[model samples]
Target: MNFTGVSGQLQFDLEKNLIQPAYDVLNIGGTGFRKIGYWSNSSGLSTTEPETLYGKSFNTSTRTPHLYSVIWPGETIATPRGWVFPNNGRPLRIAVPERVSYKDFVSKDKSPPGVRGYCIDIFEAAINLLPYPVPRTYMLYGDGKRNPQYTDLVGQVALNNFDAAVGDVTITTNRTRMVDFTQPYMESGLVVVVPVKQVKSNPWAFLKPFTIEMWLVTGAFFLLVGVVVWILEHRINHEFRGPPREQLMTIFWFSFSTMFFSHRENTVSTLGRLVLIIWLFVVLIINSSYTASLTSILTVQQLTSRIEGIDSLISSNDPIGVQDGSFSWKYLVNELNIAESRLVTLKTMEDYIKALQDGPKRGGVAAIVDELPYIELFMSATKCAFRTVGQEFTKSGWGFAFQRDSPLAVDLSTAILQLSENGDLQKIHNKWLRSSECSMQLNEMDADRLSLTSFWGLFLICGIACFIALAVFFCRILLQYRRFSPETVEGDVEEIELPPRSGRRSLRTASFKNLMDFVDKKEIEIKHMLKRKSSDNKQEASPSSDGKSHSPS
Candidate 1:
């Protein structure tokens, strides 16, 4: 159907078959509505405009009504034909959940016969923002003995037992199917809460400074340094020269003692001393890091939860707690595939604390699973004895509930968004849920042990230094071998020691291994000759200058 006039044409589908009509209309406000002139039915009975549609006229009568006056942005004008209450301005009946899981949300005072809480404050604030007054009375929904089910409270509104329901009502898909929910005032989601315990002492706590791979790498480096130093020093240094078994034992002893700077053996070769220098530097860093990590472990108090996340709870046979009538129970049983027998229903904040503290073995739950708002409220109210584990498993929000398609939902949602933008929401939240105890931070150092990554740079530097020294040592050995070879021997290069006639003859037929042995023997002989010359000099100096030489003292 279509209507054309001096005003723009209004087109709509008569059969509702089009994907989209010329206009989409909602009854809440006229800020977006356009006037397409007027219509009249001369023989029909009169009808008043709906209370929701702000600018459009729904009235029909025998006489023609005036055309709609344009309503501009930021302006609201009264309709010539407006709705009036049928029952003499009776207050709208609003249901407030009684004995809610957390009393901070909503609580009815019997002595004063009134209801007040964080939710009540927000509801009043939102209603005040609406253009017109919404007179309403709070009727408690459940008996004081037990907390009321939120779904039941919302159901009453669907059945028209109440004009609306308020107080920490969650906006969920199933609930929204029966009622409309305003924009969420409080962002929320499901979280797991578990009691935090001090880490227990372990007999092998000493090994925590380094991971197993780090320990193995460090040990390998130690043995490598020892062997390299022995190779460089054994020919010249008496301390390094020994029987095969003694030399092998010395390698381990010298390597392990370098950690404490207590090795008795001394390096005589420059290469041996250079290797020790780099090894000692690397050991210093490893020791310092190990000490710092071990000190933090021993001196600091650390808190942790046994339950890491939803998966841990699902796999365990232990009982888990949920608010008595919350959707969490259904999510755990149905969505997570957990056994119903493993769930424990908790009715109050005290119940949550008691159940968690007692633990699953003592007829209580190992953890409490609930929405963030309720969990945060519980955390703020108590000492820092519990903590949340992992991310929220489910996403949802808290909003006020109204009968299906109620026009008030849109305006109320706008008011809530305004509150959020203007900072009133934060102030309200702080007034109820903020606590100093919740400010304490967890110690991350407790769980992080040292790994090879932390000291890889030091290891790299030491390894490079050893390789460079070995390269120099190998080059000198190659130069000596070339100089002694009969064909390569040059007249300008003076030999330090001549090979025996038989050894020289053997060298002509010697393999690479035999040549290495000949070089080793020559170096040892040179060291011995130097030592004997030093001993002769000392003996000559020791003799007295008298004609008769006394025994050398």
Candidate 2:
């Protein structure tokens, strides 16, 4: 018989008539098998010469050697790729786990609708990514009311009882050993769920508004403003000059009183007034912020947790709640070394709430340990009553299960990857996982109240103002010292030099020291002269041992 192909014409004869190779020829064929022998191309099949194979040729010189050996047309011995249901139109059996807790991920009930959830939506969307349609029907893997063991659901696929298993099945090393899993559509990890309560009032609660660093910085600025004010005012402002102890008290009183806008002493110098203006502005901002923060702390109810994380639960003799038939029970025992006595099996979200509310003392668990998705769903329903403490500890992903080395795993995995890239996966996730009615509750943190970083710029402005004022004040003092020398200010006297005590003093240093001494003496004389004038005014205002008042004349 003759056959035509893109290469050229070829002829086939019965396998029995073909000359066999010199080596042993194994006759392992049935009646339907035939062999091709001759080619009429420009270059015929060749064993030694490469040109004969590349260039077309008619092999008239010798019978064409067997170019290749293959089963005759219309005889297929290899199994086909993909799901090939027997011609009876049987749909693919997809096993969906009946989850008691977090039914939003997978729910199976007989009330009209059978199977539905986040996992279901993701699976259907992924199947659509394939070029061909997959006829599938969801079969519940457990009795409709209880949580199903995921291992059993996966095992059915391995045993050929089901075509595939879907719905929140975590991929593990042991499960993978039995069946292949597609790339995960949802991330999974364990989280600690605990009940929350309002914080109680205490004596130290007043100090909760500002961090320690913030308080220290504020106190240091109070002293800084006081020092800067006295430096600028002491020379000319009579209120600033008094006994050393009195002057110290005045600096303290003036700086703090500014907070209430009740400082009695007035600034006399122009630069002193500028410094006060900047300080008052900074004080206003600080006062308003502190007032608002402290008011919120006192008026609002704060939420806190005594159990910080898994470590806290392990150290205590409290019972820990785990979802019944979950992977958490084994993880808590084997990986975390938690005692079985501390484990409590919770089958529903209501069970979780009751266990946490009763507490360990009242026959309840201290905390519920479960996967992140389940805990998040519970939190959404309860809203503000519970919170997840600490980070996710264990790591895994939810994936679909298939028979071992099934080609469907690769195609399904590719589809999931496409869904993730094009944002279809997130759309499915938001449709089921996110709740529009639940308002996310955040813990009121002390870090949010107030910090030094918030007001550093204002403080910088005030500091710069004080620095400029002090610079001007010092410049005036230096000018006065140079114009009125010590010899001229006091009575003229012969100069006498004393030897330095330890460090040798230069002429410039000695002159500066003498000028400072002269300034101090002049300041003292001014104070005494003012005191004498005050006394004279008092004496004139009064009568000498008589009721009549006396004038200076």
Candidate 3:
């Protein structure tokens, strides 16, 4: 059979020959990853070459599963005796499961530490992160699907499980619950996903320091207020240095006119004008810093942790959230000896990410999460993502899970250690270290939270707020202690009532409003009557003064 020079046939033959190897490589991505080496020349990851390989799917439910085999290099094939490697070299082929090998085409996870497939690793690592002496864990088991048996579990009943059960369980109910939730573990609660009808206002942004717009408004308001006060009180048409009754009338007129005539006058003193300018500065500059601090627009919190380390999270009474069934969730509720009520378990990675952003149940959350890569995945999808710090709250050993408490746990750990000892762990780690979601950065929230520095921003924010409040109170005290009224000190138009703003709603205000309404109505009626009389007079008069009056026909 001379096969030569047939282009169509040749191409077909080439493709046919390539198909098996390609399929094998696609299935045995782990083996191909090894052959490809640890670092890709482009991405700097050996196994995760092209980066997207880890997220690829098999397109079919995989069966071969890339069963791991520990082998020696260069099998010494005797005619009959069987496999052997030379020089006692341990040539290993870790048959990574196609569903879980980070390089496998069927794997969907970007981070191998917390994904459902990664939980076994996390469990192992978290166990190791603790101070030995494993707690006899009584795990609450569920595969995340609805359990027909727990039909009675609804709202507070399901939520109350947190109190009744000894550990964390993910919640899915949406109706309001009377029971309190711990931090989220596996799922976020309900969401209202609707397109914004209009551009929405920033949430509580007013709590932030003054914006440039606000600063401008503040400057204008203060300047305008001060100038109006200076003009009406200091340089008005009325006589000053006088007694009570006349002074009240002058103040009333000033109070009324100054609102509109703020910019109309030029009688304000230089010192008074300077004071207005200073007030503008305070409004513009001082409040801007205040607003920024209050709103927390700065990502300085990202640079550090809220609690710092795993130890802090483990030790604190603070409620912690975890993606249910995750290593962090397991460790905190089990090994760390945190109460079940202290753990909030969410159902999905998305919910867990959201729970982290939602923060603590008691004003703040202390969470245990996969240290870096897991957080990076969240930042890849959303802004204002959270972080973990302080010695990786728990280190997780990445592994494919089997049915609970299976002997595969130990076997897999042994296999993983074997791979680690032979540098496969480094290879895997290096591969993941380059993905954008994995590589961006990490917030050692705990480390930073506990560090002398991260707490400093909070200290400063609180300190400044306290200082301002104290200053305001102290200034008011000095003013109050003296017989001088606020009307004199700031040239305020309103009379200083001896009582607090809370003294009463002021029936006088209602009476004054009613009196004004009556006067306005009477004035309108008088004008109408006068117009009618004038018309009648024009119809009846012959002459007035030096003019003849015309009569209506």
Provide TM-scores for the models: 0.64, 0.63, 0.28
Q: What 10-residue stretch in candidate 1 is worst by lDDT?
A: 42-51
How does each model score on lDDT? 0.75, 0.76, 0.37
User: Over the stretch 1-553, how does candidate 1's per-residue lDDT look in tens digits?
Assistant: 6666563454556665432223322223333455434222221221332222334444444345444454422244533223222233677888988875678778886654378788888888898787755667789988877777888888889999998998889888889988999999988899888887555788988898788999999999999999889878876787877788999999999999999989999998898898899899899888988998887676554544457778887777889898877888778887888888888888888888889888877788888889998888788777667877778988889999988878788889999999999999888878766643554434445355788888899899889888888888778766655545432221233333546776675545544554556445446674554466568677887664453566456
lDDT of 2 by residue, 352-459 (tens): 889988888789988899988788778778775777777788899999999987877898999999999999999988888865343334346564479988988998
Clashes of each: 0, 7, 45
TM-score of candidate 3 on Cα atoms, chains taken together: 0.28
Model 3: per-residue Cα lDDT over 204-313, one tens digit each: 64434434554454344444444344333342222421455754555455333433444333433343344334444443444445644543433333432345455666
Ranking by TM-score: 1, 2, 3
Clash count in backbone of candidate 2 = 7
Most TM-score-accurate candidate: 1
Q: In model 1, what is the error at residue 139, expressed in angstroms?
A: 1.0
Which ranges of candidate 1 are over 4 A from the true structure? 1-87, 110-113, 200-206, 226-306, 435-447, 451-469, 485-553
Comparing 1 and 2 on lDDT, the stronger one: 2
lDDT of 2 at 236: 73
Model 2, residue 143: distance off in Å is 2.5
Q: Of models 2 and 3, which has the larger lDDT?
A: 2
